[model samples]
Target: MKRPSAWHLVLAPLALLFALPLLWLLVSSVMTNAEINRFPPALIPSGIDLGGYRYVLGNALFPRWFVNSMIVSAVAVTANLAFGTLGGYAFARIRFAGSKLMLGMMLATMVIPFQLTMIPTFLVMKSLGLIDTLGALIIPSLVTPLAVFLFRQFFVSLPRELEEAAWIDGCGRLRILVSIVLPLARPALSTVAVLTFLSTWNDLTWPLIAINSDSNYTLQLGLTTFQGQHHTQWAAVMAGNVITVLPVLLGFLLAQKAFIRSLASTGLKG
Candidate 1:
């Protein structure tokens, strides 16, 4: 038998460290209030309690909030993919006036804190009559600089010969992008999609500031109701958070291989 690798000793501890919070969340969701409030905090519950799940699921508005989150995430992901892909491809291949300046400007915006732009974004959404609506959330996130940058990096590494050959065959630039470029960019596409979905689904701050109507609240925003000035429902909040994150967690797990592959490929080549 082969001797154990030394890396296992280091990795095992690190893995547990990262997993601790999520493990705590899962276990605490099923623990009684008395059990959870114990001084040391219970890692294992003596008995399971469904009180949290019941509390959250019993609320009629929960379903509406879930649907609202789904709509916003779906639209944001689709819009980012469509627009980011095009913009990235242009930055990667097409030579246009001030293209480098534009790319630099776009990348620069990514460094600026979102907190600085929130008020201006809210005002813009209000002027467009999108405030207090799902559109308010969707419109601002339709495309992001990170998404565009990822696509551009991935596209830049693609072989010019393939695009040239397509051009020789009289294929239009758009057609070439659709047929030749995108097929090979599956890994990047998957990465962008998963990232976009995760961001949009988990976003609460902007939605909170923009949407006053409870009916328009996203899942993350709706989960906040479990807490109030006097009473805080820890169990329900924990359970609601679990439900809120479940889809994003599952999507990441399923797409993790592709996601990692995309980033690695992008980093190495382009």
Candidate 2:
């Protein structure tokens, strides 16, 4: 193992500062719902209780919402990885008329806030009879412009020699992409996958607009049901919030190495 750099030492405190909130959430979740609602929030739990987890998992709609979120995130990640890579490769390696214009248009779409297109997007989904369905969530987020951009940037840094070598080996473009280019593009692929998963998992607005059925609700959307116009269950709400956040936290923890390596590799490529 290598020794820690001076910069690592200097940044240790900053890292902890950023992580404190997450640590608090994890700790608070184990506390009784009553403990969480108390004044001057309890940083430590008196006793670990599974009640919070029970409430969230046992809720009539939570399990369905969980499954919905998982499906959306999984499908979105797969689409982003496949289409984003192909799109990125085209933008980086392929030459054709209006290629630059098309990329620019895609980038322009990213600039337009989702809020501006929310109603129109919802209307489109409704017209397609996709309302109250997972298709509405999965289709719109299948491949985002940002994912394409990230992959394109990373792909540009790759040497053309590899693709050419694959061609010399009598591999077709699709075969080269699948067997040669993709294997080496793991860093960028991991980055795109992690980002797409996180975004689709946490997305609330589109799900709220697209899904009206309880069975199709996402974790974020289901969490909102814990709140009422007249009375809010703060404890259960916090519990749900904790439940909603756990998968993201666990996913990041398990994939942090790949994620950071991707960023570092991309930065060096730039």
* Model 1 worst lDDT run, 10 consecutive residues: 225-234
Query: What is the per-residue lDDT of model 2 for residues 1-270, given as tens digits with 9 covering 90 to 100?
Result: 988799977699999999898777677667776776678867788888877677767778778888889999999999999999999988998889999999999988977988999999999999999999999998899999988999899889989998997788888778887888899998888899987887899888898889887888888888776555212345555667787888988887898897677557647744
Residue-wise C-alpha lDDT for candidate 1, range 91-149, written one tens digit per residue: 99999999999999999998799899999999999999989999999888999998999
lDDT of 1 at 123: 93
Cα-based TM-score, every candidate: 0.85, 0.83
Question: The CA-based lDDT of model 1 is what?
Answer: 0.87
Clashing pairs in 1: none
User: Stretches of candidate 1 above 4 Å error?
Assistant: 3-14, 32-43, 229-232, 260-270
Give the root-mean-square deviation of each candidate in angstroms: 3.0, 3.9
Best by lDDT: 1
